[model samples]
Target: MTEIRLITFDLDNTLWDVGEVLHHAEQQMRQWLDANVPEYTRTLDRDALTKIRTAVVTERPQLGHNVSALRQEVLFRGIVSCGYPATEARRYARSAFATFFQARQEVVFFEHALEALGELAASYQLGALTNGNADIQRVGLDRFFSFAFSSADVAASKPAPDIFHAALNHAGVAPQQCIHVGDNLIDDVHGAGSVGMHTIWVKLSDQPNTIGHTQPSEVVEDLAELPGAVSRIHTA
Candidate 1:
């Protein structure tokens, strides 16, 4: 077996429960908007904002990869529609997005997440490959992750080959010398596998592997099992 030199991780659900973090962040952002730009809060509801997001992505498909831009554009449009001038709308949108982004970084890791990363980082170079807008620096994950890439970095999200290829290039490793660990079957398993890298599926639940055509080299339900799984793959 080729020696595994790099291990790329998905940040969102793999490291922490993103749904709760996002919900809390949204509330914090909404509170900021209400205090600063009451008009936006009064005018746009969740459904309305969702429709604007859909339109924004529809007109500019490239924004799909850069979620930060997509969200800021939505805020700008919503603020403008609420009768704010373009200049004020842009300023408010940026401020609101910053507030949301800061709040978004407040993540609670899964049990043993830090410990597992520490163990893995001792022997292998650790990288992060995420489609979401979570900043590793803001989240204080920079100590564990030597390099990080997001969808925005390569203008392509997972299930696409660009981000994985970027990691390979950055690490200077062949596909067989890398392993990608992520929670999603399609985005993590299929995506890395498509690029000829080994994969470990972080199955947080009992959901059956519905993607029958693709299989991960290892499946682990908890981060505690991560180092062992990687060791097994490395030896095999």
Candidate 2:
């Protein structure tokens, strides 16, 4: 194996608890809607909101990469469904999404994630490649990463080779000289492995081992163990 030159990462579960952050962000968005778009809030229930989001995604499949646009579109259509005019719905949608986006950036890093990033960044080029729309800079994590890419920017989500290839291009390294770290077995492990990159599976959930051509080269329970694990892989 080539010496690891660039270490790419998946943002959501690798560095922070995204599920909890999103829950709080959604709550904040709901509160803002109740205060500003009372009529829309009153008209749409939780189930109705899911239906509207589903409809939005179904109608606009291109949003598969851009989660922010997908959410804003859902807000706009939900407002329209509440009988608001297009212009009014557009205004409310922007405001509501702004509320959500702001709350979304208030992230809490996982145990040892920051220190691990600092140590890793000192030795290797670090890049963030994520399917979600989380802004590394906005969340105060930009200092650790040399570069960042999102599904929105590249118009291609992971599990596809395009995003990884984009990272390779920017870093000017061969796939063999890169390793991708993330929580998801498929998106991070299988995806990077398929492109001939080393893989580290952050086992945060009860996901089964991938049963295919790609598999993790290493697995660690937390970020604290990552540096050592990465060293082992690179030296092997």
Candidate 3:
């Protein structure tokens, strides 16, 4: 068995509960809409905004461009379609959506998240690979990771091997020497495994049980369990 010298983490649901944070963001966006775009209050509800955003993103997959930029575009479209003046729509959209994006930065890390990161960082070269705009530097997790790569920066999202390969290259390690941990089954586990990197599925309650679905090197319920899992591979 190969010793694991590098441990890469997925940002959103791995280190923190992304669903909770996104719920808060959605709440904030709805409040902003209600306060600013009062005319379409009944029509442009939270569910409506979410549906429209999903459709727009699906239709314009190429515009997986920038999460923030895409988010802004979606909010602007929502507001304009609600009958707001174009100038007012742009203004409120920028102000309201910027607040929502900034709120994502306030996402709370799981208990022991930093401790687990620090522990892992001590022995192995640590890096991060995320699909979203999780600015590790801005989030103050930069110290824990030697290198951080995002789909936004790589121009390729997860389930694509390029993003994973980019992280491996950044860490100066081979695929076999590193392990990727993420919450998503397809993007984090299957994708990394496809590229010859060991993978750990960070199981979350919201996600269905993927135990028999895809083979990861391991499955951990929380980030705190990661260090031991990685150590076992190194020792074996």
Candidate 4:
């Protein structure tokens, strides 16, 4: 059996509950806007801002991968709509996005996430392949990865082959020699599988774990169970 040479990971939801983190980050941004630019607080409330973000991504599909730019653009647009001049809008957008970003990086990891990664990192070349803007360095997880590629890095997100291929080439490994661990069935499991890599699905819940009736190569309940699952897959 071929040994797994490189292991790539998904960030949000796989390592931490991203939904809660994002919600808190949004609240932080709202508070900042209320204190600094009070008009935006009234005009770009949560729901309104969500619609603006959706519209920005919808109109410029490529912005989906570049979350930082997408966010800045949304803030700029929102501020402009609320009667701010273009110059002040841009300035405020940069400052506001920075505030939200700091809060976003304050992630609370899942149980045993760091311990399991430490164990795996000893024997394998670890990498991160995420569609989010989460900075491994900021999150104190940079020590685990030899390389980390985000959608911003590759100009494309998961379920696409580009980011997967980037990680494979970075590690100088073939698809069969790599394994991708992620929580999403389609973007993580099927995405890596489509590129001919092995996959481990981090099934956090008992929800249906199939992509159009096709199951992942392996499934684990949490990061604590990941090391054993990877060991089994390496020799299978």
Candidate 5:
């Protein structure tokens, strides 16, 4: 294998507990809505919210790649459905999304995630490749990553080659010289492998490795083990 010159990461779950962050962010957004748009909050149910979101994605397929836009559009339609005029609905949508987006950046990093990235960044070019809307800059990880790409940036998400290819192009490295580290088996392992890049799977020790057929070059249960995994691949 070519020496690993660049290491790209999946932002959401690889470095932080995204599930907790998202749940909290959603709660924060709900509180904001309840305070500012009482009528919309009173009328909107889970089913109704899902319907609005679905309609937004279905009607405007391009928003599928842009989660932030998709979410704002959903909120706009939901508010308008509650009898707000288009201008007021648009303003409310932006404010609600701002609340959500701000809360979303309040992420708790996985144990030793920062230390691992700090160590690896010293020797290799580090980049972020994600399908989610999490901004590395807003997440306070911009110091470590030389570049970052999202589904919105490439108009395609992982499991497709667009994101991985964008990372390679941005880093100016061949696929063989890069390794992608992510928690998802298919998105991280199979996606990078398809483009001839190596992969390291960051599965928690307790999680079941159901997709064992999609192999990664390395596997680390903890972020502390990440640097060693990359080193082993580098020296191979």
Candidate 6:
């Protein structure tokens, strides 16, 4: 295999606990809504809000909308469904949803992310490619990545070759010279492998060995193990 010179990462589940982040964000949204929209305080709870948001997203999948837009829409629609006027619904939606989405910047990184990123950035070109709008700048990980590409920016999500190719192009590296690390088997391992890039599966939880069914690659439980995994692949 060609010597690996570039390393691209998937942001959400790889370097951060997305579950924890989303959980906190949800709680924050609920508290904000309850305080501001007294009528909603009695009617809409977090679970109901979540279900309505899911329905909206499923119904409008082709809108290519971001989470922020969807959240606002869900809040407004939920208020209107509860017999609130359009003007009042829009007002509460803007205030409550902005508070929640902006607070997402407080999400914490994985324990090993800083040390691993520092070590690898010293030796190889580091980049990020994510299917979601995980603002690296807001997350304070922007300095570690040489380039960052998001599905929102590229109009193509993971499991698609276009997102990976965009990351390689931004990093000025060829497929054979880069290894893509992510938590999803199909999106990270299979997609990167399809383009001749090495793969690293960051097993955040006890995930099954799905990669075994596809092309063989390295696996690590945490970001700290990533440097060694890359070294082994290079020396193999």
In terms of lDDT, the best-performing candidate is: 1
* Model 3 per-residue lDDT tens digits across residues 124-210: 888888888767887899898878887778777888999888988877788999899888889889889999999888885567774
- Model 4 bad stretches (over 4 Å): 211-214
TM-score of each: 0.98, 0.95, 0.86, 0.95, 0.97, 0.86
Candidate 2: misplaced stretches above 4 Å? 209-213
Query: Tens digits of per-residue lDDT for model 6 on 1-236?
Result: 45888999888888887887777887787788777776776887779878888888789873343556776888898988788899989998898877777777676778888999999889998888887667778888778887788776676667779888897888778888898898888888888888889998888788886555557468888788988999988777
lDDT of 5 by residue, 4-92 (tens): 89999998889998899999999999999999998887999999999988888888888999889999999999999999999999999
Candidate 1 per-residue lDDT, tens place, 108-167, comes to 999999999999999999999999999999998999999999999899999899999999
Measured with C-alpha atoms, the lDDT of residue 48 in candidate 1 is 96
lDDT of 3 at 50: 81
Each model's backbone clash number: 0, 0, 0, 0, 0, 0
Clash count for candidate 1 is: 0
Whole-model Cα lDDT of every candidate shown, in order: 0.94, 0.89, 0.82, 0.91, 0.91, 0.81
lDDT of 1 at 199: 94
Candidate 3 lDDT at 166 equals 90
> What is the overall TM-score of model 5 with all chains considered together?
0.97
- Candidate 3 yields a Cα-based lDDT of 0.82
Please list the residue runs of candidate 5 whose C-alpha ends up more than 4 Å from where it truly belongs after superposition.
none
**All candidates: CA RMSD (Å):** 1.0, 1.5, 2.6, 1.5, 1.1, 2.5
- How well does candidate 6 score on lDDT at residue 4? 84
Ranking by lDDT: 1, 5, 4, 2, 3, 6
